[model samples]
Structure formats: C-alpha cells, structure tokens
Target: MRHYQPGSVVQMVRDAIVGRCRHIAPRTFLMVAAAVTGLVTGVTAYLLKKMIVFVSKSVIGIIHPDGFSLWFVLLALCGIILSAVFQRYVVRDYVEDGCSRIIMRDLRERKYYLKKRDMIAAFMASSITLGFGGSAGAEGPIAFTGGAIGSNLGRFAGARKSDVRLLIGIGAGAGIAGIFQAPLGGMLFTLEIMAMPMTTWAVMALALGCVTSAMTSASLAGFRIDFPVGSFSDFSLGLLPAVLLLGLFCGLYSVYYNTTGNIAAGLIARVRTWWGRAVVSGLMLGVCVSMVPMLYGEGYSAMGRLMSGDYGVLGVNSVFSDMATPPSLILLAGAVLVLKGIAKASATRGGGVGGDFAPTLFAGCVAGFFFAQVSDALFGVRLPPVEMAFVGMAGVMAGAVRAPLMAAFLVAEMSGTYRIFFPIIIVAAVSYATARIAERVIRNVKSCAERAR
Candidate 1:
C-alpha cells in the first residue's frame, strides 16, 4: 500500500481537496455561490445604469436638449425601428416579461440557463429603448440580466438544480438592490413578487445577496437616493381618513392602469411583424408626447419636481416651455396620470424593450399628486402634497405588484427617512387589500359568465 511515485502525493492532495468540496453541504455551497452572484450582479447593474444615463444624456440630450421636440420624437422612432431590426435579424427573440420568463423556465425545466447572447441582447435592447425616450423602466432588464448571471454562475459552480433557482432569486434581488440601493426592498421583492420560498436558509441567502449588491452599488455610486422628499412635520391623525381614501383611490386607479395596459397590449399584439408594431406604437407614443411632453422617458424628472412642490416646472427641460396656470397644471397632471399607464403599456407591447416597474412608480406619483391637488381644491385641506405623493408611490406599487412590504420599504428607502412609515404602511396595506379584493371580484364575474355560457 505504501508504494507511491513522486507525483502520488500531489495527486492525493488534489483528490482530498475535491473530496472536501464535494462534502460541503448544498445549502452552504449555495450561500457562498449567492454571495459571488450578488457581487457580480451588483457590478453589472451599476455599469448598466451608468451606460443608460450616458446614452440618454450624450445621445438624446445632445439631439433634443428640450425634451419631446420633433427631433426627439424622430429619434425615438428611429430607435424603436433599429431595435425591431436588431431583434428580428440578430436576437431572433425578444423577452417580454423578463421576470416571469425566468420563473417559468425554472418551473418547467427544473433547471435554468441564461445564454450569454440573450443577456447581451436584452441589455442592448433595453438601453436603446429607454435612451431614446421609450416610456419604460430598467428594472426588468436589469433583473433578468442579474438572474442570468446567477444561473450561469451556479451552473459553473456545480450547484444543484434547485439551488440554481434560489441563486436566480438572489441575483434578481441583488439587481433590485443595486438599482434602488435598498437592500430590504430587494429582499422583500424577491420573497414577495418572485415567490421565492421562505425557508430560513433561503431568506439568509437572499438577504446576503441583497446586502452585498446594495452595498456594492452604494459604495461605487456614492449612496444616492432617488427621490429625497424633505422632512414631514405635519403629522395629523385627522388625515387618517383622507389617507385611507387616497389608498382606495390608488387601488382603483391601479386596476384601471392594469386593464388599460392589457387592452393596449392585446391591440398591439395584432401586428404580425415587429417593425409594424414598432411603427404603430412609435407613432402613438409620439402623438402622446407631442401633447404632454412630460410623458417622455421614465417620468422621474417630473416626479421629482412634483415631490419638490415644483408644479410650474412640468416640461421644464422639455420642448413644451409654456408655463401653465395652477388650474391648467392640475388638469395637465390629471391627464398625465390618466394616460401614462396606457403609454407605458403600449411601449412595452409595441416592440419597445422596457419594463413595467418604472411605469407603476410613475403612476403612483401621479395618483398621489392628483389626490393632493383634488383635496386642496375641494376640501381646502392643507395637506402636504409631497407627503401624499410619497404615500401614493407606495400605494400604487403595492397594489399593482401585490408586494406591500416591498413597496413600503422601497418608498422609505427612496425618501431617505422613515418618518412617514405609518402612512406608507397604511397606504400599502389598504391598496394591497383593495387590489386583491378587486381581482377576486373580477375573477368571480368572469367565472359566472363562463358558467352562463
């Protein structure tokens, strides 16, 4: 047994190392793998966001410093056309519901693998879609990209099939964390929206990934929060009823937004060719932008202004330079709040590569501000619009996505304080409950109709 060559000891050590690695618990290995995934996903998300900003500023800004001009509209059309051509000729397939696709793949195949080419294609398409004023969000593409990265990494590391799904969740959460710089929000989104199993091990892994990713992005990006609404010292128990009413309103509006978006998507789906859909959607979007101008891009700039009490600043940097009276501003805001969802839905279904994530937030902002304006006009309530705007943001997100915890945490994190935590929670809970009830009612009605048929 003791007869060994000079290389025998080296080979024995190599075997021992391999054996040790094999002996590691699957959960332990998955946790470690998740950390690596989070790191990579965070870095990738950071770079992707910067790329979008650079493209939007350098390309779109140079061409149309005043937003939603004819030049901007033409460029948006061209970008959509180019994206359609790329999808047809090069990618050959476009991912519509990025998160849903990832979840479906794992459910059907028991394994997940994101092709390198698909990741690149999604990234490029999303960049072009948003950079050229497509009314969409970056969250969907970024989440998909993160899942792809995690899936591939897990496969490379010899993780089990089940473990790969968890890794995908971890990466997705990390992506959200990176984008919003909100670790808790990311974890909750993964748990609630992605329907990630809530085992202790899974939670730990997701938390680890989200924290790592958020920290990574924050460190690199200097920890900038998206919308920083100032302090809210006007806490009034008298406003509780109004807050509840606002929540109900937001829930109803969410239903309307979802219905409108579905209808728009169905209509757009009638187009057989990608370029045809692009042209139709592009023309529709151009018409919308030509009128509102603030409907351009993700509407974040408009949202920020609303939160900062800058009502007269609508289309400030855009082509519609005419400042409006307070009454007209209210009407314009109402129009934007009503039509923005349809526009966003059209963009997504009409061959534009973007996500519904940002649209929901935009709708929430509009709903909140609209509620404030109405309250001030009707009841002469001295309610703070900014505070209501923040609440509305949480309300719409919760109702639309059915993720109250995530929505609340996201709003809190974005606002850089938890002073309004109670209001945020109230709005989120009410909106979520209302949305669920409404969905149930719709389902019952549909079922009754089917039975009658």
Candidate 2:
C-alpha cells in the first residue's frame, strides 16, 4: 500500500533483503583481531605439543636412581593426579559436549573471542591431561583455547554474533590444523562437527573462516608438519571388498563409542559432589596409569608403531604372522580405549574443564587398530592396514558427529594421496551408514529398557 520513492525503490529493497552491512568504518582492527585469535590458538597448540614432548622426555630421563631420575614416570603420575585435581577443583570447564565444546560454546552461547585469562586456565587443564600420561589427544584443548580467544575477542571487540561464531570456528580449526598439520581436516571438522546443520550462506562463512584460520596456522607452524602416520601399503584391487568390510566394522564400533560415551556422561552427571568424584577419578586414573604403560600421553608414538606394520595371530598374545597382523594388539589397544573413557568421564565429572572429542578420537584410533587386525584374521588376507587404520579414524569420528562426508574429507585431506582419496570416501560412507543404523537400534533398546524400569 505504501508508495515507493520515484528511484529509491531499489535502495529500499536492497536494504530490506541484504540488511545493513556494518563495517565499523572498515578499520584493520577486526581483521587483526581474527588473525590474532588464529595465531593464539596456533601458537598455543604448537607450544602445547612442545611442552608435552619436553616434559615427557624429562620424565623418561628421570627414571633411573642416580643419573636417571625416572622423573617422567613421576611426572606422569603427578600430572595424572593433578589433572584429576584440576577437573574437580579448578576451571570446572565442561559446557556443551558431544563433538567438541568450543563449537558448542561459540554457536549455542555466542561466546566468541577467547579471553587470555580464560584460555590460560584451559591450557593448564589440558596440559595436565597430557602430562600425566592420560590417554587423550590435543584437539580438545586446542579447540578450547581457540574458542576462548575467539569468543573473548569478539565480546571485547563488539562484533556481531555471526561474525563472532565464525571467528571461534576459525580459531578452533587453526588450533587443530596446526597440531596435526592437517589444515583442510581442521577446517572441514570445524564446519561439519562444530556447527549445527547450517544454511548455505552460513556454511560458506564457517568454511571460509575455518579454512583461512587453518592455513594461517599452517603457515606459522610449517607448510606441513610431518608426524608419524600409520603404515599404508600399496593399494590392490583385491582390497576393495575388505575396505568395504572394514568400513562396516568401524561403523559398528562407532555405535559402541557413542553409546558408551553417553553412558559415561550420564554416570558423571549422576554424581553431585565434585571433590568426591575427583578423588575417586584420580585414584582410578592412578591405578590405570600404574597398570597400563601405553595409556599415557597423546599415544601418538604408540599409534605410529601399531600402524607402521601389522601384528598377526588372534588375540593379544599372537605373534605377527608376517608384519601385518593387527589382531595381536587388540588387548593393548583396548586398554588404551578403556582408560581414555575413564579419564575423560572422570575429568568432566571430577572438575577438569575440557572437551571429550580428543579422548574420543584417541579411542577411535585404537578401535580402528583392532578392527583392522580382526578383519585381517577373518579374511585370512592382509589388506592395507594402514589405509584401514585411517579409515577407522574417520569412521569413529563420523559416529560422533553424524557427518560422513566431512569425516571422509577430513581424513583424506589430512592423510590420503590423490590416488587413495576415492577409497577413503568409500570407507567413510559405509562406516557412517553402519554407525547410524546401529545407533538407532541401540537407542531403541535403551528407550524400551528405560520405559520398563
């Protein structure tokens, strides 16, 4: 009913549709803030890695009476205890959880721009988790540090909520990318795992921010920081069926992962007393640390060894049939998986403020290791366990996030050559579907049981 201005109609329409694009006078300030957030996450991740390696080396050196103090073991023990203590008494940092907390905080709460003071506390919490030989990964802390910087910065800078969320994703992606030197994976992960089902425009914004942050982090760290990955063999056409089979196996395992994780979270939530939970978790972790040697730290070194070749035979006691038997390492891998679950749940319940994604990834990798071994035994043929291991990684991750494409892309971008990309895709898709079906079935049973109770 309103008459449009003679020539102002177009301008009015544009204003209504596009909204006001506030630039704040287009100052370099916002750009700098974003870059700074990325840098902080990157530098923190890099530094964290170095810190763990340095302290870990010292710990190993101190193992002797005179010259060798075996301080690494003591440090490990202390670090484990301290982590338990921190979770219970310190930061108390569990917010939204499932995939990663950083994602949850940024998207759900609009807590953009991480504050330095807040980040340092988170850094300490994660450092203790790694220092004490706890079976965890660095991704959670990296994301936490990144998210804090982004959330705090945005809050201080007065950015729009959308912009702030993007910044947090960027920082988180950068943090993870820098550590694994997997820029694309980090970017995709932030988009796929961190953000909720996004609109096209929002997806573009998130992906761009995450990717840029990852690239910046990689530039600061290195073009590609090489770490030990699993041993991948030459691809053979004969392995296609096995690859598909392996993918399905991983999917089933992923259901186990998510289900157990939910149960663990529920268990922690049931407890009311923080210190009581912390002390109990600490004692449990201490006993686990004492009992299992490889359950400590990031488990990278162990993962590399397990993936480099295969240990044949069935069960934990089997000798390598050749060098590709994965079955024999099941017990060892299973131990790490169990302790990681305990450490993660204990930390959340007990008081250590952190995310569970890292622990989940670590457990997934170990589960993948076992899956590859079992597949080799069942078929009586040695497929490329290395590639299978990587497939396992994506599969487990897919279960958590329910994003098969992203999971596949994350792994391929991180590790696969051009040649193996398609195979990785195949594996990830199968794994995702498998996990989804199994999850539905398990949830149905669980619901029924609860109703009966």
Candidates' TM-scores? 0.90, 0.76
Task: Count residue pairs with overlapping backbones in model 1.
Answer: 1
CA deviation > 4 Å runs, candidate 2: 1-33, 64-77, 84-99, 102-106, 110-116, 196-234, 265-271, 310-331, 334-340, 353-355, 416-418, 449-453
Model 2 misses residue 304 by how many Å?
1.6
Mind giving the per-residue lDDT tens digits that candidate 1 earns over 22-90? 889878887888788888888887887887777778776566555445765675677677667776778
**lDDT (C-alpha) at residue 172 in model 2:** 71
Worst 10 residues of 1 by lDDT: 95-104
Itemize residue pairs with steric clashes in candidate 1. 67-318
Model 2 residue 345 distance off true place after TM-score fit, in angstroms: 3.1
